[model samples]
Target: MVSELRIGILGAGGIAERAMVEPAHEVEGVRVVAIGARDPERARAFAERWDLPKHGDYETILSDPDIDLVYLALPPITHAEWGIRALEAGKHVLCEKPLSVNGTTASAIADAAAATGRRAFVGFHYRLHSFTRRLLDVIASGVLGDIERVDVDFSIPHFVVKPGNIRLDGDLGGGAVMDVGCYAVDLIRAAWGEPAVESATAVLSDDDPRIDLQTDAVLRLSSGAPVHVRGSFIGDDQGAMSLRIEGSEARLAATSVIVPQWGATLRVSAGDGLLLEEKAAEGDNSYARQLEHLVAVLADGSPSILDVRRGVGTMRVVDEIYRAAGLEPR
Candidate 1:
């Protein structure tokens, strides 16, 4: 067993700074050893700001034997290649989602991880939250008997900002589904266990015909439970994120299911009346919890809940959604 886990940041971007580097300090038995970027000066600035010991190009971090893990915050298109390289270098990888541009690449990453025996975790931090665990427990308890339907919608109006942002680039695997819609799709898969995409329709962006501004998909689980998911990058709605699960006996609804760091509420209703209501306490950081779990997995060879295999399953759904919508997979 390892005494400590040393993590190297492979990208000096916003997610690397806010989600990984900052939250890593709060996780025990892990340290951020170095940061790498295309520009060495930018990497140096990020490393200095985060109080890390070293900063250099990507090769430098990859060559360092002291780094046990690599946190990849690169674009979705680059995830599979860099992830495979990191695993080949005998280092575990925690990559930001969507794991790859398509299902094939995601599967390749999973295969590489298996071959290397290196742990690969996707950055679906919400799965590590206490409230999400409670939500799963409630679902498994059978209180909401026989879930029949699930509705998920996550929309944000911020797509209008930064005209040339990567999220708007079709070649770079940018779209509503690839960006925010992934979370909704992941939530559905988490609840329904990898449903098959029945159908999907998307509204393409006016500026870029290949990119979707909004997408809606219908899926069916093995048990025939139908799930309706909608994601939008540009919408009239006031930035909403919620999920509703309807069962034969009762209904469960949660608000802000995506980023519950601020706080979240779950309400359950039955035929008689409102059955239960719960709210997440303040100071709940999913990133910290996720990092700690990865450290545990690295040190003791424990199973990770959001392993690379799960990432491949999620990406398979994503690829099918694009095909169903009559669009090529990004």
Candidate 2:
């Protein structure tokens, strides 16, 4: 059996409690060695529950000699600072999505990781799903002929209403575009192989002046294809999240694109009026699979799918979207 990777969690927030702490315990080649949080009581409680070593400050965990990896589940604004510190401390890091609040910070962390010779991975867990992998293959294979246009919708319910949640604040790197809209941008770039954003137009709501709670933009790609993206915090809980690509000879619609827990549905309509649909098998834990991939890559010294370079590009697009909307990135 492969040696279990020793992991230390930097934050015991909701994500750490629900996704990392629980599922990681179930993986064979993984072990939770330590946890750190701002609150001593809370961190200790989490460690007691998970049977791990707990610390009130992140540096305590970082200094531990037994930990092999560190997972940063902190706020987006703090991602770069903590990530850099962890890498300099000689710990491999798996940072949560968006990489950072903007492209500049993202690039800084990426450079730090490269300089340290330490493995760096992002928590773009959607890329780990088998269904999404197969969809990427189909798109790259050109089975549907030349691409024409792409329409994407990424939305979620109002899940966070608490005060100072960090997700709704603009200065702390919170917004509809920064949150749910990232998926739309990344998936489009992945399909197009490059983000040739010639121009963009966006509509913002007035309810939240601090952030773009509702944003819809039209982006032009290098291939001369027009892609429309709609991301919002005001959509219904039952709203759709998928990408529809119109090609020369066929059209591809990826149903259940955002929330793969509902299972993925792919539909292809050929020029001859024939249509085909298929559903992707579901897994209980995407987070587990993502960690598994990180461990495997670290073991073999292979590259990761969502490495720092890709994350920097995604953040750059996000910075552009914010600029087009007449809002300076926070």
- The whole-model lDDT of each prediction reads 0.86, 0.79
TM-score of 2: 0.92
Choose the strongest candidate by lDDT.
1
lDDT for predicted candidate 2 compared with the true structure: 0.79
Model 2: per-residue Cα lDDT over 38-115, one tens digit each: 887888988888888655579888898788888998888988999999999998888887788899999999999999
TM-scores of the models, in the order given: 0.96, 0.92
Candidate 1 lDDT by residue in tens digits, 94-201: 889888898899988899999998888889998888888888788878899998898888887654534788888887789888887888878877766878899999
- Candidate that would win on TM-score: 1
RMSD of each: 1.4, 2.3
For model 2, the stretches where C-alpha displacement exceeds 4 angstroms are 158-164, 198-208, 271-275
